[model samples]
Target: MTRDKNKKKPPAVQQEKLNPRELNTEENKHSNHPLLDTASAEIKKYLHDLIEEFKDVLLIQVRQDIKKLIKEMTSPAQENTDGRTEEIRKEREASEEEFKHNLEYMKQIQREYQETQNSIEYWQNALTETKDNLLKLEERFRAYERERKSLLKITRNQKEAILKLEDDKKIHNLRIKNVSEEAGTSKNEIQKIFTEILKQNFPRIAKRNDIQIKEAYRTPATYNQNRSTPRHIIIEIPEIHQKNRILKAARERMQVTYNGKSIKITADLSTQTLKSRREWGEIFQVLKEKNMQPKFIYPSKLSLKINEEIRYFQDKEELWEFVATNPTLQRALKDITEKERKRYQDYSYSGREASVNGADHGMRE
Candidate 1:
């Protein structure tokens, strides 16, 4: 079962000619052969062991390969997903190479068939068995493809759901940006600064102490920059109404400043929501350039109000498809389509493998 990569088969054995057509009359001729049944049993055993060995490794490889494929598909950035995508590509290449090697081994069996003429039924069975292995690989590959598509759909939905949940959690949370990123800064200092900003802009609620800060801290992940501080403080309060009140006070005030430095107060959004909003921002600008106005309904709905009726775009594909049909955005959509295709070109699969072995296979690959 072990093959020395550099080792060559014996010339006499390698060149042995085999008449596979003997299979047509094999049952008639081998019916009376004494050794036929024993040889058939041995061949079947060899095939069973070989197939079982390969199947175990193949199933494991397919599991890992499909996981990588799903990860690559779900990632938003093509540049970063290359490593996992390459893992999938290598898996397929390995599968193809193994398939080719197995095919060659099957051919060796065919060539050796003449040696088993006295036991023709056994040789026939060996040929039949080798082909089943090939068909097994083909069948598994098809299953992998089906599973990949199903996982991708499920993952996309899950990502959207996770983002929605995260946004919901932050309903009672607000963020402060462009504040000091100084080390050794305490939460009390941040809380004090925020209270002053709120008390100035929102006297009614600030006087009543309705805007209470349960906890406040500077975000941990920060980059040091000479020109500006990196970290922003996040203030967590108890009630959604208090959070809403703070947001409304900031909006009502034309500008909110702390320690003579301008501070921005905004609703805390999940990374997914921010990314979606960023992408939509560009699309909105594109619409504006076309002399068309698009409405962004809160929580990720893009719509066009035409004749007092709203036409909604649920996702990027729908929005782009609508754009491409519009006379104004057609040119831009063409470029976008080409970019998207190029970005995802690596995800394509041919679903091909080496040819099946044996002269005649009813168990088709």
Candidate 2:
């Protein structure tokens, strides 16, 4: 029993023993652990604060730099602004100058147009006036032509009348010449016969006046035998009373003298007596009794003749008057007059010699 009790007691008192080196190693590890942990946490907290402060500082510096750059870029420059303003002013001035030039040019063109218009109007008015004058001149020319035609007609009539008058004068002269030739009478003898015829036909003149009769005798015996007779007869009668008597005697004589001759006689009424029908009829009957036929030439024919003569004479007178007024014509006329005088003197001398020779021959015979 004792032994088992002792063993149990011993076993209750026994313990485990550690190594020194291992104990030291484990103590060191434990001792360094608190230091490492504290160091890591301190380092972490320090890094967080440093990062926050650096972020704040960086943001503030960036904002300041951006503001400075903007100020530099956006600021106005005085010199450049002034230059731009001056350039704008110059452009405005140039525009105004161009407008003024254009206005002046337009005004010049308008003035030229107005002047041209005025010239055209003046020319038109002148042309119108000239046309009017020309028309008036044409009218005047037409009037002149009408007047000329009238004058020409008058001239033609006058010429025909003048020719008829000349023919009548020629016929009368021819009749006188023929009668003188046929009678074989001297001018004085014929005149005496005419006077006797007037006295015989004019009873009123024969009764009113005393006529002395004379005759030509070949011998003194014949003269003594016809002592009461005169060689010529003179009847003292007025010309007015003798005219009608002379015409009657001439008609009676013509009937006796031209018994077998183809003789035609005509009596015309005087224009003054034409209105007196009784006087005209009496004259007509007287002419018919003397075997004379009366013919009436148109009054207009006679008037035309007179007018023609007048016109012809007027033209001749105009020419003669002009010539007479000229000194050259006057000298020419004087020369002609002198020449005519010389010719007349020569003819008179020749005629006197011929007359003297004829008288000598008559005395010898």
Candidate 3:
């Protein structure tokens, strides 16, 4: 193209793009200043392009970092929410299990309480029944006590009447003891043997043969060869006066004999009367030793000259009471009274027995 002088002419380097590195070469250093301007412009353009590229790269990196930071922050919050939900679910499950266990425990307590109530009711019913039975037993026992007392009174009265009838059958009898028994002896021969005894012992009596014998016989007993003593004979006198006379004569002699053998003559009384007479022997001896002039009145009555008066005692209690009034008798019989008191307490015999003995003691030969 033709150069246009009227306008400003462009540089030759400026007509083409230039490398900034080419301007620094030795060849270009010698070239025109316009080339430097072109190089500077190219350098500026390259710097601007580099700056834009770096900015784009930095912006992309910053965007990626922001997304990563936002992901980091948001992911942790979601995880925390998930973990909290799981923990809440587990807590709720544990609470439900605990509640179930508590409910079962409360049910067991209710069952035990019901059983306790049932047991208490059973014991209360049993106690009420036992109390009722005890009341019934007490009532029955009182009734039995009254009946027993009534029966005791009736038994005591019946016993007294029986003893009195037994003594009346033995009133007018005389017995001989230790008479030698001869074999083949008859009742008539027994009578003759007694007649001879009266004749031999009572020869001084006026008309001793006039003492009539109602009957005479050996007492009923089985004969034994080993017997040490002979059996006794009974002499029943028809007249009471004659019996008394024979007794008086026999007592004065103090010794009666038959066929050169000693024998005894005594009133034949009931066993009860004999026992009663034997009991009076101790008191009789005591009174006789004291010079009281004691004597037997009848079956068992003791007649003692106490203070110049005769006193009758029905029992040991009566005698003990009588002795209490007299100092000399009490002192003399203190040991005997103590022994009798001990025996009385031990035997515990009712006064009815002594009264019965007293009622029956009036019979005598």
Candidate 4:
């Protein structure tokens, strides 16, 4: 056994134990090794301070740059806002000026329209007044025309009346001349006889006569020469009657005798013989000269023959007196004269028509 034990004896364990100073010294030595200790101290103290200083400088720089950027952006925006406001003001002023010009133009047009209306009114009134004046003038003209027509009618009637009076006077004078010549006496003697006859038949006409009578006698030789034949004595008679009476006396005395007829105191007759027949023609000639024919005195030819038969008795004083006293004969004579005057007047107005009708219906016809 012992032999085996020798082979296994472990080496004696040596345990070293040091003082505190010695242990501290060894620890320091290990920690103070050049690379290890110096490197650690430098990193903690110097490097950490440098990094803090750099971070502060970077923060100050960033703040300054941001302030400058803010000032630059705000200045430009403010200027643009001011410029936009001024532009809007100018546009408003221009619009106001345009509106004022339009208002003035409208007023001018209104004034012109009013003046034109006044002119139209004035012309219309003038036309109305002119029309009224024309109507008044037309009425006056009509009144004047009516008065002129009335005056013309009055003048025509007066003219006809005057013409009728003149004709009666002329006929009366002619009858007086015929009576004086046939009576074979002075005009005064014929006037006296007519006056006496007028006194008996128409006393009014006889009283107005201013006449005288003278005797008339035939020569002895003249009486003896015609003694074998019936004595032809003409007696003077005055024309004292009106025109109508004288015409009637002449008409009553008118005769166509086969033989000699006796002479009435109022009218003369031809001799009582065949040669005396020629005297009847002379009586008709006298009637024609006086513008009185048998047709004019009588309405029909038959009445004219009857009148001639009644006149055969030439010595009928009553018949002669009746003719001398008639009044209508004068009216017939006057009508003839008026017709002649009107014929001439009508010839001037209506030409030939007036003349022809006047002649056909006149007293002379």
Highest lDDT against the true fold, candidate: 3
Query: What is the full ranking by TM-score, best candidate first?
Result: 3, 1, 2, 4
lDDT of 3 by residue, 140-171 (tens): 54544444334434553443234345544444
Report the Cα lDDT for candidate 4.
Answer: 0.44
**Cα lDDT, all candidates:** 0.67, 0.45, 0.69, 0.44
Deviating ranges (above 4 Å) for candidate 4: 1-102, 163-365
lDDT of predicted model 2: 0.45
Is 1 or 3 the stronger prediction by lDDT? 3
Question: Better model by lDDT, 2 or 3?
Answer: 3
Candidate 3: where is the Cα deviation over 4 Å?
A: 1-167, 183-185, 335-341, 348-365
lDDT by residue (1-365, candidate 1, tens digit) is 34334334322322224366764366577676555566566667767766776786789899999999987787766655697689889999999999999999998888787567747887778889989987987786566545554554465578668877888877667888877665224778878878787776677877897667887877764555654555777888888887877777787886888767788998888877777777666667666664556865544667764445567875565565475567545654443446544433333322111111211131353
Among all windows of 10 consecutive residues in model 1, the one with the lowest summed lDDT is: 351-360
The numbered model that scores best in TM-score is 3
Candidate numbers, best lDDT first, in rank order: 3, 1, 2, 4
Per-residue lDDT for 1-365 in model 2, tens only? Answer: 34334332211212224366864675576656564456456666666655675676678788898888877765556567788889999999999999999999999999998999999999999999999999987875565444444444465457546644644332221012112223324446545544444354445545665433232111112224344532221222234224334445556656422223323222232333233233234333443443434333322121111212311122222223444565643443353445544554565456445554544455468
Worst ten-residue run, lDDT, model 4?
296-305
**Whose lDDT is higher: candidate 1's or candidate 2's?**
1
